[model samples]
Target: MNSLRLAAGAGPSGRALIELREVWKTYRMGKVEVHALRGVSLAVAEHEFLAVMGPSGSGKSTLMHLMGCLDLPTRGTILFDGADISSLKGSELAEIRGRQIGFVFQTFNLVHTLTALENVELPMIFQGAPRASRRARAVELLERVGLSDRLQHRPNELSGGEQQRVAIARALANDPKIVLCDEPTGNLDSAAGMRVLESLRDLNEEGRTVILVTHDAEAAGYARRRVQMRDGRMVEAAEEALR
Candidate 1:
């Protein structure tokens, strides 16, 4: 696989929007202490598209959680837009996450009872946006993701690709600067997955920072830069190991 070579913790733009310095995450399962991340350090730039590739149990999801502000690191520093977020309170972290970061998942976690439009509007509602404004933004976002015709369809009414597109639209509802996607194409067929990947590429071209975590190299190809994780540590390349 072709890859870009750059200094560690630096992006094309030379400005780090998110930085993880000597980060470590450990989980305790009663009798055993599991280390999910081992002194990992990474930097994501303002509009960079980065892919984190790893096998199962490599701690890729744990890294995403930390980057998305969903959880805190057990040891080390996390900086968001030049602000150290490791010490931020839960409420403060939530506020930053709601306003500045968005997330997409492999499961396409949409509200089963809500229409596509309603699902897209959920984030704005959380931010206390006016109904009219949120609705308008949702419409724009859905259209942006090429879901203009399926606004009224529920998750079950749409195909896996369509539902994933709705999830992408919802992720953009709050106009977040950073989007974290964890195995977004895991459940789709090749064609559908390509379409979803294209949408993500478009979003990145439009200037939103995107971080994708996937084990599939095809998915990683959509990113401008790629990093590998192994046994809780970041490795420059692990293709041979993967094979």
Candidate 2:
């Protein structure tokens, strides 16, 4: 594993942490076929804060899924830390997802029956972390997200922002190198959305590779790099000029 680096800009310079080479993803529905990603090639440097923006059916979500290992590309190669994962089996991919990738979605997917702390602890539990370590780490993560006071609250009892914070904490449980967020603030009001964005920024600052998928320009502005997609293809891409 590479030693992680933290910075205010696009993070420390290193080998490509994520690389996609001519990737394509297609789906078949009845007699029709849908192409979600079309020959996409890209790379994300270690600790980069990348925003993937596209309209509906533009394939940004599919790109995110491919990068996060939730789904494999239909054709082409995907390398994570230089390891080709595009051809991995389901169990192999699941291991990668647990150890190297974290995911956040618009829907706060915290288990309704689990308290915030418990929810944050779930991933570590899956990783076979001991109970004491899991509890301690969960508390630390909740505090990192400014949700220490809401630890015992279930999803139904907390505000949307609080619940999202819990979800973020849960995603960080496995200490993944990459954090994939898909319209993470689409369900929140402006205030809550800002809080979530700030948390993601903080995570990026702390050396996590943050790949955000969203349609909102304001949300995309938080990232140091932006890639625009349309009709299943990348139309434009840019990185912030360093000061």
Q: Candidate 1 lDDT (Cα, whole model)?
A: 0.89
Error of 2 at 15 (Å): 1.0
Candidate 2 has a TM-score of 0.93
lDDT (10s digit) by residue, model 2, range 1-243: 011111112234757888887788999999899999888877888888999999988999899989988888889888988789966889898889998888898998888989999999988887899999999999999998999899999999999888888999999999999899999999999999999999999899999999999999999999988878898887776557541
Error of 2 at 212 (Å): 0.7
The candidate that achieves the highest lDDT relative to the unseen native structure: 1
- lDDT per residue as tens, model 1, 40-86: 88888899889999999999999999999999999989899999997
Q: Worst ten-residue run, lDDT, model 2?
A: 1-10
C-alpha RMSD by candidate, in order:
4.1, 5.0
lDDT (C-alpha) at residue 67 in model 1: 95
